[model samples]
Target: MNSMPYIDQKGRVYKYGEFFPPELSPFAYNETIAQEYFPLTKEQAQEQGYSWKDPEPRNYEIQIKNNQIPDHIKDVGD
Candidate 1:
């Protein structure tokens, strides 16, 4: 049996319709709801019907970590 294409919160398509990781499934649905509402707060997000936990904080950390210079760059203490 083939899996359905998973639509992500950002409306991104993944896998055989399944998200890259199942863990992200909730975000996909939540994202869709957020977009439909156009502007939503943490409380509004829930009211609007998003199910996944807030991703902003986690995403921020990821962005910061990704943009940080590698240890090698700082190790030199230039």
Candidate 2:
């Protein structure tokens, strides 16, 4: 109704620090620790109304080499 809580495109209202319902959560069951402990197959998880996600490939660029960095705090200068 206000900035304290606002309605989403789906008509759901949310506020910071408030607990969100599992069904309304942004994370898929497979993306959370629940999958690590429970460990369900993709078919099983989706059948139970939980979402699953495929792993994404990540590529990071190395900006600096380890040897190029200063080893001590005092070694760094503007």
Candidate 3:
């Protein structure tokens, strides 16, 4: 699934259709502002014109038959 990227005023990229929490205010679902307000697609937001912040990878997990959990959270039951 290709997620449509949206840039915020702070140059933070947020994928469209994703659940943006209340902590991420000032980011609206208005598509009209995408072109004018935020023209960069996550990859284009560079402060010094060279580096851009990458999104954090989804929770690390090991697939076993069908179960998954973050690597940080160890399962004592295992």
Candidate whose TM-score is highest: 2
lDDT of 3: 0.49
**lDDT by residue for model 3 over 17-57, one digit each (tens)?**
67663235444322334537756654453431333334568
Ranking by lDDT: 2, 1, 3
Off by over 4 Å in 3: 1-3, 21-78
Model 2 residue runs over 4 Å out of place are 1-24
Q: Backbone clashes in each candidate structure, one number apiece?
A: 6, 0, 0
Error of 2 at 36 (Å): 2.0
Candidate 2 lDDT over residue span 10-61, tens digit each: 5667677766635566889999999989999988887665778898898989
**Candidate 3 C-alpha error for residue 67, in Å:** 68
Candidate 2: the clashing residue pairs are: none
lDDT tens digits by residue: candidate 1, 1-78: 246666655665565633254343446444665456675566655553455455665443353455465667555444
- Per-model CA lDDT versus the true structure: 0.53, 0.78, 0.49
Cα-based TM-score, every candidate: 0.25, 0.56, 0.21
Instruction: Show the lowest summed lDDT stretch of 10 residues, model 2.
Output: 1-10
Candidate 1: residue 58 Cα off by (Å): 6.9
- TM-score of model number 3: 0.21
